[model samples]
Target: MTLTQDAAAAEAAAHPRRESVYRPGHPVDIRRTVGMLRRGPGDPTMVFDGAVIWRTVRTSRGAATLALRAVGDEIRASAWGAGADEALETVPALCGAHDDPSGFDPSHHPLIAEVARRSPGIRLARTNEVFDALACAILEQKVTGLEAFRAWRLLVTKFGHRAPGPTPRPMYAAPTASEWHRIPSWDWHRAGVQPPQSKTIVRTAARADSLARAFRAATTGDDRDRVLTSLPGIGVWTSAETRLRALGDPDAVSVGDYHLAHEVGHALTGHRTDDDGMLELLAPWAGHRQRVIRLIFASGVSEPRRGPRLTPADHRRH
Candidate 1:
């Protein structure tokens, strides 16, 4: 059998015959989208075996597992569970089928152009899971990646359900919105989640339905931004992070991120810069700010590390 045919058979057996294939017009690296789905190394919802990436997610129907792999120029997706159809349907957008870089002239900026030239396969990924992405962003508020990921692992492991279908390892699906709101304060504390962050998630989940509706109705970038930021505790940074991952929005720039400005500054100019400075530098690339930033990161340009690293606070101790 051809690789494509083999993959189709593997998928059919796994998901009651629900399978799909997608080929990008340009080169697309599967791992580039990994960061969008993965929370941390210990994330129980996602697993990356040597060959394929297996992920479990909760849909309106039920829990489902999706196995995704890149075969030559095509991406093969298979899934199982009551939500298998919904899960498989999302494969294309998740694999960059919706990415449009039209009118984005890389030649205008030498640094960005060079990065794009070197790695022509980079494509932004979108999840379209609003509540899950919002909840994850909330946990990441005012914390180091390690701290947030640790908290996320604890939260999901304790409250989430076992993954569906055959997987490389035991996996879990993130709890539903109600489950998040129902978690006791002690459990949140035990998970090292601060009160503010935990409360924000609970409140966000409380209006999850309305938020989903608003997102569905929103047609413009401004509409989406307003809907996301209207909720308490969500700001420019958090909203941008959510939009970039959930919607694959090219214009969402994480302006307040800790290191983004400095990295962009050093890559575009010769020195580090503040948020205002970075915004000034990126003004020309208004609609593609995040794309430009990703390119800068892909270029491996970073500001020199000086001063002590951020200490991971033990909220449980407090």
Candidate 2:
């Protein structure tokens, strides 16, 4: 490397870590915001210390790790690594600081109203990390949570970098899109990522930079969702899932989710419902549909499991 570039990098690295503080208008639940980022118990990119939540994210500039905590009105954050500034800037969004729920006047439904009352701090978080959101959603496509999370843990542990922070636990950043594209087929097979999902990841990675242009061009959350859906293998469920995290579109609903419809149906109408029924049921909530879904999850009522669970097809055992 040129001496000038080397000096620049050293200077950048020498820059002290940044800290940010924000005051949301309403109560902000740190745990719920962390839950939005967590994939499973063993997610290598996310860790919860007793007081603070640490997250390692792969940003456009580079990888970054942030220690985040919220108490009362103030949200506190400190970040490290190349993308530290970017991460610190986005901390408020990650904590749902910009989420406005005043317009979501609840219907007269007893359960929805009650759940809303019970959970004042529940807000949908937006990370604005599109590639990571899309990749994770693709990982979760058509699989049990166990299978998807295992695959995610395996891939990230193997290919991702150690988080750059003084985190209490070892955390890793999700791999860059280019790194994901370079992973061999055998590695994916070993990670329990089947062909369909793996192919989608590779294709998306190839066009990941181009997809960012669409996001930049989008003026509304709906437009951003459509831009994501334009990619092959990115359907309604995946797009909704990605937007819920990447854009925090309150209206985004995972329409084709295997269990979401049933749970929503049971909660709303006292019976199980399909995708169409769930959409119809959620129509009234329009702009705040995902917020309503979050409330339902907060309500602690889900449809009873009746069918056989999806068994993991461990290709490594083949």
Global lDDT of each candidate: 0.83, 0.84
Give the per-residue lDDT of model 1 (tens digit) for 1-318: 999668646655755736888777678877766445799888888888877888886888877888999899988888887788888878878877788888777876899999999887777888887888889988998899999999899889889876667777778889999999999999999988899999999998999988977875787667887998887888878888888888888878887888888888898998999999998988888788878887887888888898999889898988
How well does candidate 2 match the true structure in TM-score terms? 0.90
Clashes of each: 0, 0
lDDT value for model 1: 0.83
Quick one: best lDDT, which candidate? 2
- What are the RMSDs of all candidates, in order? 5.2, 4.4
Superposing every Cα of model 2 onto the true structure, what RMSD results? Answer: 4.4
In terms of TM-score, the best-performing candidate is 1
